[model samples]
Target: MPVIVAASALLFSSASLAHQLKSSVTTVLFNKRTHNIELMHRFYLHDTEHAIEHIVGKQADMLNSKSDQLQFADYVAQHVAIKTPESESIKLKNVGFEVDGKFFWVYQEAPMPAEPLSGLQMSHGALQELWPTQVNMVNIEGQGKVRTVYFDQQNQWHTVTF
Candidate 1:
């Protein structure tokens, strides 16, 4: 009985020190009128700041430092890429990013192809470098279809058709 109690205490203490799960969600949507695909990426501020510090330096701070925030956004722009059905990469305009409460959002828009999509390819590789257990969730919504994909060490791009 004493041994069981001691083992349970050790298990609980070990679990308490384990790192929490890390995740982010990216949403892609197409606007018919504007002929552009809009992207919104949401990430928890705590994890994001931690990631920035991990990649750049320990002193880096996203919420307090303007350069840190821009650097983080630039990191997002570099990792994400969009390709049309014709296999041509679309130009992405990183409009801006914002920190609202506990989360941050990065906005981007890419001009849609002149021809209708036979298929779309989006490569979103965020946070995987910072943490091996990071999971990047991407959801594409537009037309009549909505699709979701998860990115880990083995996953990168999310490709689907309407």
Candidate 2:
């Protein structure tokens, strides 16, 4: 019917204008087998492409450009931090990054810090500089109960005791 066709057109138009979630998820997990702390970060591919263009001051081909992806991975590493209870930096080595489906992933790993992860300080500011509304959620696992922390424009750092 004419009414059904009009409704379908409206829905398709609205969907085209819908924005992405503007969020990223990072998970910090302790590997029991390797005794290492592994960090995995996932960001919406669309967001990353725009962000890279904004930072690079030119159009970026994130999907096909390996160097661009690696550059973004390095930028992410510089923006995040993890420190011990004693305020010692827990250096996380950049493992790698890759685009998988609709998501871009970055990986980092380091030897698990001395046990009893108490007063661990963490920060994630990957894309917040560009998008004020962006939210980065970090989930800590392999530490008894999974704890979650959210970082945004206002709250950049968090201390977690486990």
Residues 5-90 of candidate 2: C-alpha lDDT, one tens digit per residue: 99999998887755655889999998898899899999988988999888888788889999889888988999899998778899
TM-score (all chains, Cα) for each model: 0.84, 0.88
Count backbone overlaps in model 1. Answer: 0
lDDT tens digits, residue span 1-162, model 1: 999999999998876654376888988888887888999999888887887887787777767787878888888899899897666899899989989898888889988777778778878888888788888888888857788888888878667787
The model with the greatest lDDT is 2
Candidate 1 residue 113 C-alpha distance from true site, Å: 1.1
Best by TM-score: 2
Q: After superposition, how far is residue 147 of candidate 2 from its true place, in Å?
A: 0.6
Query: Each prediction's Cα lDDT score?
Result: 0.83, 0.89
The alpha-carbon deviation from the true structure for residue 142 of candidate 1, after best TM-score superposition, in angstroms, is: 1.3
lDDT of 2 at 112: 84
